[model samples]
Target: GESVGLHLPTLSVQEGDNSIINCAYSNSASDYFIWYKQESGKGPQFIIDIRSNMDKRQGQRVTVLLNKTVKHLSLQIAATQPGDSAVYFCAENESGGGADGLTFGKGTHLIIQP
Candidate 1:
């Protein structure tokens, strides 16, 4: 897949500060967007999601902004904590249905300095 290119695998951030995670997508036909946060070895938890019809969406201390015009998406975490430190991943689902799996980016490792 085109998304599987060589890329850096981690990110470091300080605690109590805002963290911004960026993602670049290639499929123009993709319509659904999702942001997930995984702590250590647990499964990814859904943080927020936005459809192509909207550009921004918010939930609790997290916000997701989608820019379909440029094929980009971002996840913003406010007041990052040591517990909040984890691997964040942004995913996209194409318009068509079926077992087509989610295309996930390399992910950003959020290191919170407590």
Candidate 2:
């Protein structure tokens, strides 16, 4: 079974700005990593992904950085907006493949400043 401890589920953001959130993951051996954004009880949408082989990856206005040396990760959003306000989650493919689901890290609340 996948195990994660997320205490909060909501975030508040303004009209436009920037946001940064952090997550700590288990299973230092996980190879594949992904970040997702979920809006108001909706399904998670893929934002970016990084393999254990790499330390950083970038998207349109988003960037994800991984530190294998510390088992930590972070998401950086540029020009954050009300639309960008959402729940962000990090997941790892701890199972390698098949049958096992991706293990998720405790999500963070991203509040954008106007």
Candidate 3:
């Protein structure tokens, strides 16, 4: 099950299944994008990243897809597990040759069902 409120969106999946998390960014000028996963009471951990020049990228058991045209990004997790349960967020940066910092999306909570 999932819930949506003033907080982030949610996606629930059963163990052993695959999970797809989607995000929409507001910055068209952002040249870089990164996906992060955060567990309860912990900092966000980097999952993967893709540049504006690229449409897709892959990591261990994860994939990040970028659609510049629609300003959308999605993360695909190969195998759902309890450990994978967390809130996933996408960040965009327009640093443009310098580190200007990043702006993050609201995030989506990934719930793994037993």
Q: Pick the lDDT winner.
A: 3
lDDT per model vs. reference: 0.81, 0.75, 0.82
Better of 2 and 3 by TM-score: 3
Over the stretch 34-102, how does candidate 2's per-residue lDDT look in tens digits? 898887779989999898899999999899888888777777788787678777998888554523767
Query: Global lDDT for candidate 1?
Result: 0.81
Residue 47 CA displacement from its true place in model 1, Å: 0.8
Return the candidate ranking by lDDT, descending.
Answer: 3, 1, 2
Task: Report the poorest 10 consecutive residues by lDDT, candidate 2.
Answer: 1-10
Please list the residue runs of candidate 1 whose C-alpha ends up more than 4 Å from where it truly belongs after superposition.
Answer: 4-8, 97-99
Clash-forming residue pairs, model 2: 17-80
The total of clashing pairs for model 3 equals 0
CA shift at 25, candidate 1, in angstroms? 0.2
